[model samples]
Target chain A: MRIGFIGFGEVGYEMSKGFLTEDPQAQFFVYDPLYEKEETQQRAKKTHATLFSDPQSVAKETLDVLFVAVPAPFAEDAWRSIWSELNEETLHVDLTTASAQVKQRLGEDMLNEKRTFIDGAIMGALKVYQHKVPIMVSGTGSTSLIDWGKSTHMNLTYAGDLPGDATNIKFIRSIFTKGLSALLHEVMQAADKLALDDIILDSITRTMDKEPFEQIINRLISSNVIHSQRREKEMENVIDFLNSHGIEPQMTKATRDKLKMITQANILEKNQGDPPKDWKQVMRLVNCT
Target chain B: MRIGFIGFGEVGYEMSKGFLTEDPQAQFFVYDPLYEKEETQQRAKKTHATLFSDPQSVAKETLDVLFVAVPAPFAEDAWRSIWSELNEETLHVDLTTASAQVKQRLGEDMLNEKRTFIDGAIMGALKVYQHKVPIMVSGTGSTSLIDWGKSTHMNLTYAGDLPGDATNIKFIRSIFTKGLSALLHEVMQAADKLALDDIILDSITRTMDKEPFEQIINRLISSNVIHSQRREKEMENVIDFLNSHGIEPQMTKATRDKLKMITQANILEKNQGDPPKDWKQVMRLVNCT
Candidate 1:
């Protein structure tokens, strides 16, 4: 079966390989805008699948299933450009962290073309993609299409007749789980500043005792991961949207303020290259732990 | 040994009962302006402890250890008005959740007089007080005093040769763990509104297989407990106080905003009742397994 995978990002590439990992005999074709990056190029070398130059080329490949491994809201403008290029025979399944509203638009298009559209979301990270993480798929008229997920070595859990059930779950959970990681970064630091770092930890531990406190603290606590720092602003954007919707942002606001104070406050003072006061203190705090 | 307890509120009364639970021979006495509630009254009835009418009566009894379980800041001022009535031999242990500033003042006062002062923070609910959950204590002249914790059944973990060490840990952990519970509330609801709750639960279960998700989510998720409907206002107060110290309020703003809209826009307006939403629905949003 020819499978056309779009958007070879981190999750995208992992899933593409996941499909192959489940069934070696399956023919795979992939396309990503950033596929020329050194990492993507190296990934392509190992996968040994058809790498298309553009979306149209992947679309032209007489694919049985068109897997959209793109990012959240994968494409703006209602995915019109990508939709217009797809063959009517191919089925489309989105594995991105997308919203139901965006999926509704694409759902209308898929229904019009009489093609199967599966609302899908990956429940686990890349390394453990298909092994234990059953990819949850749901939507109108998807009972027949999920067989592809099952056949391709993916444990497909049929999520009932909702147009965007799985992705909806992924986004909401991410808002908190990832949001907690962000929350930990902000709260721990704030408490640490008050010279109540241990007290802060105890207050959280409460009646529950499980993981080594340090591991949970470090993962949730800030370790100065420059890459993760951007999440503060992104969380702010989410909180702002929640605020616009008249809902409280909770940890998202705390997260944003912390990020803003650390990242942006320095820009105003012209302090460059020096780590955030928080970044430095977190290290010292953890050492004391 | 004559052990004295001030403030026969739930925590103090429970801790005193816990003392009796393990060591029935340990004499217990309680003193509070207000009478103990039903739970405490029942405990005191069963334990057969003497109830003193005022703090002076307990102090005049010349107790080996005086466990002050009263509320803080307010209690700080409360103690000030009545402190001159107490005996100098009393080793004061404040298990109340007082601020660092209050502990510092009290610690300094006791230090100058050569009286032992132990600052402690109670962890877990009263149920776990003597059974398992630890009560952390911080103070140098604490060992001889805390030996009664063993004879009279208190699970005490001492920090260092300082008055603030134990309280510091409790406060630091509180910032993240309790903050997590608050953060979970907002995100869980976000999932609930979106109707992607199951996926949210599955994602966390799959992603964080080792962590204790159930207890954490139960404490934070709104469905289980009625998160203060006025949570936004209360959280803002929590954040503002923390922020006044140059330490940020971690989940303060976001937690407030995340729920204010939903509670105000959805639950408060559409549904009416305590814990108006089902707890499972809320936990499903936190996606903690």
Candidate 2:
């Protein structure tokens, strides 16, 4: 099987190496602006692959699979440049962090052109997971790639038939992971100032470990109405404290606003003293407010 | 030792119940507005404890320990109302989510009045951990509480000698826990909308279980400089996508801003292609920017 890679950057390079490890005899074509670098040249030589100067040339090959692992900002341009070179049989997989809407547009365009396009959103650190990294794919033509991926021991899931379903899942997941990491960073600063980062981290780990994610969400949402007022008041003080400390407190402010909004919505009024049974109900209440 | 609880609220009730379980002969005096409630009255009778109508009465009992478990906003007021009633030897322990400033002010006031004040910040769900829940304490009066807490099988940590140190630790910790919960709730809504909550939660658990929290933090901070641009672009799209779905995108927007700020700082410029050796260094770079 011949595989072509467009951008030989961090994730793309790691994935290419994984392919070589799985099947050393796999034919390969690569194109990267840094192809002339000693590292890139040596990698290509070891894999018995040809290094093309242009993305178009790499796509010109009638490969079994072509992975487009470019940066998200350049994903659309790269797709358009490779459009003329892809054959109807080539399975084009994109691993960029593009939004679902962007992925959907590309998926529609490729389908109209009688080609297969798979929106493969990779999750986790590429360096750590390597070939075992999880990828969520969604498109009309993702079934074949999913099968191929599983056969090679790749952690791949077929999200849905919608072009951007996989991307949507990835972005939504980011709202938790990246958002948490950013908040943690800000928190670490404040904790460090107090010289209590270790103790605070210990507390965080304890809370996270002691409860299942589902239970935590249910508990927090169900008690939202009962505690919103207290939380809002406390969070206001928190926001002011953080601001005085020279931090912007974006997340803190948002948390305070969300709590206040939930209180204003009066979700408790609907239940007459009982809390919402599900997080979805709470969310609906939030949106309504 | 005679123990008095001034709030007799959710957390106060849990802690008192735990204390009773640990020492069946223990005596308690509780003061709460809901003391007339059948549940509170029954609990007091079951524990063979006294009930008081006012915080002042609870403080006036000449008890060895007095626990002030009021809401954060009222924490200061509760302390002031009880100050005149407390004897010189009474150990005052406050378990509220009050700001560090508020805690410090109360601590100083109590100390000036010739009483020991321990700024104790309880961590975790009172309903879950009960008396075994972790508490971080600060101020000069914390050492005795730590010894007492350990003897009674309560999880306690002496954060530092600073009056507001414990509250500082708690608020910083709250930034991460509350921020993550809010982000998770938003993600859950989006996932529920797509009927992918199960799959996404599975993926989240897998990733979390695959790596230790420390390792995850290190890896993110270390490779941050290299991937900041990609992450910033991806997060920007995430913010837009979340907004399009009617989610307020507070956490998402904060995540995007943090990423952009880090990239703009260009920490890599100082390292000259080398990643930071520790998270503290990364944070320093972020603060510098």
Which model scores highest in TM-score? 2
Docking class of 1: incorrect
All candidates: CA RMSD in angstroms? 17.0, 5.0
Q: Which stretches of candidate 1 lie over 4 Å from their true place?
A: A6-57, A69-89, A95-98, A122-136, A140-158, A190-289, B6-57, B74-90, B126-134, B211-289
Choose the strongest candidate by DockQ.
2
Q: What's the number of clashes in each of the models?
A: 34, 0
What is each predicted model's overall lDDT from 0 to 1?
0.58, 0.78
Q: B238-270, model 1: which lDDT tens digit per residue?
A: 454334424344444554555454354343223
Tens digit of per-residue lDDT, candidate 2, span B96-184: 87778888888787777777888888876788888899888888678988887777899988888777888888778777766666667
Residue pairs in clash, model 2:
none
Residue A41's lDDT in candidate 2: 82
DockQ of each: 0.16, 0.43
Second chain TM-score for model 2: 0.81
Q: Interface RMSD (Å), each candidate?
A: 15.1, 2.3
Query: How does each model score on TM-score?
Result: 0.60, 0.78
